[model samples]
Target: MSVRPVVRQLFRIEQLVDMLLALTGKEISRLQQILRSGTVVYHYYRYWWEGFEAVTEDLQVLLAKFPDADPSQAFRAEQCTAAAIEQAETQAPAKKMEVEIPREAASRKRLLRARSLWECLMQLAHENIPAYKTYSYGRHADIYVWEILPDVRGRLEKAVERFAPRELRAPLRRILQSSGALRLRFFVPR
Candidate 1:
């Protein structure tokens, strides 16, 4: 089934925040080195490492508006809680989750301090959490949507719906031609 646009947009933000939280672990230095070394096979995917860091910096700016005492701790707590819930359910042999009980050992694996952010991300991804997602931009290599948290999707939709038809075709054309996307083209998630 297709995901609703609102859910997709919200999940995108949640995903980016999760990644940033993973990046803040105690062994960040080691994780950073592992990330910089190209975690993927192809040399081109190495761009992802730099892209992840750059996106983290940008996401931090976006997060600054909604300050929290310790988002990383909160994120870890949420993960642990979610794992516990799943593990609890797995104890019921009649439940469908019995097929997957073996992997739920993660619920009991509590660490006082995360030893590697990269490893944490890998675990999250293995659990089907949206740690990161990338797609080709088509026109230009690839574009990232590193979770511009808040109701950016809604706000942008309203802005476009409000501005698109009423505004002239000439001015937008001139801006697109001269400035080259100084003003972003309207984005409507399908």
Candidate 2:
């Protein structure tokens, strides 16, 4: 077996590894953006929940204006009804429960995945090519700048910007700095 062919094979393998690292970094950045955005939405709902009590009270008062109303008939007839009022009240708690539980769960899962990817990127950064680490953060910035659907990303960006600093921002920034990607903007401004 010739040494030249073996060397060529090794070079190809190294290139392949490099490519995979780039892709992984990009994926990490994308996931970070997503996770951060999800965090924003979670907080928005939390804030909404905070105001929900007042909203429910107001709704109850509005329904009380029509004491003799059949809530189901009101809803079905586009008028106020007791049954519809009851149903709305009953559903409010369930809706709130759904919002709190699933949104939080999904947000947490996205954060976990993003953190795992960040850890992987950090590990890769410690290797010979540190570019991947920088690339990872840059890719996240790009997704925030581009790619992300505007309406959704706008709300997400706002939510993430509002919620991130206390949670993941500082740690992620420190990690990026440690990895030599100091110029990367991973956190949305508070």
Candidate 3:
């Protein structure tokens, strides 16, 4: 089935965040700050990698559905774009030399940290969970409805209908109990 592009992008970002956490054992607050500001260089690199994967997957699915079509022709435009990005990444210096060694060294240090973060995410994704499960989180208690039922959207709609501002806490608890949404529980102590 074709996934929505926005959902795919959100899933990729979630994966990137998970990878960052696994790699550095960094605080969630710091990661949230990085995502919020969109300033970190590594975030750009990770997003590029995820975008490449999404495009590649889209190409694969389209080709599978239409084997006779020249998929390469469709993908040529993206291929060119990917090539340009690769070239830019390769030519870009870790830091400009005119500043000083310390600043340049710091940039190199951050880049290395980002690489390690990416590696950890890859390792986690490969080890214990299916690719789709990589995007799952505890806060989204409604995810269980999607997992268990065929009519996920319908179930979510019903839940939203029954939802009330005052009754939220108890209803959420009941839903969690009924759905077993907390099965893959992991504790991250503050």
Q: Which portions of model 3 show Cα errors greater than 4 Å?
A: 1-11, 22-24, 43-190
* Tens digits of per-residue lDDT for model 1, 62-179: 5454323331221222322111011112334474121111122322233453322223323433443322122122211111112222343344333323332222223322322331
Q: Which 10-residue span in candidate 3 carries the lowest summed lDDT?
A: 78-87
lDDT of every predicted structure (CA atoms): 0.29, 0.25, 0.28
- The lDDT, on a scale of 0 to 1, for candidate 2 is 0.25
2 or 3: which has the higher TM-score? 3
User: What stretches of model 2 exceed 4 Å from their correct place?
Assistant: 1-146, 161-165, 169-190
Candidate 1 wrongly placed segments (more than 4 Å): 1-20, 40-47, 50-84, 88-190
RMSD of candidate 3 to true structure, Å: 24.1
Cα lDDT of model 1 overall? 0.29
Instruction: Score residue 91 of candidate 2 by CA lDDT.
Output: 29
lDDT of 2 by residue, 1-190 (tens): 5342212123232232233333333233443343333322221221111111223443344334322212122111111011000111222455321011111221332432343223322222233121111112212221111122234334433433344334444443333223111221121111
> What ranking emerges by lDDT with the best candidate at the front?
1, 3, 2
TM-score quality measure for candidate 3: 0.18
Which TM-score value belongs to model 1? 0.18
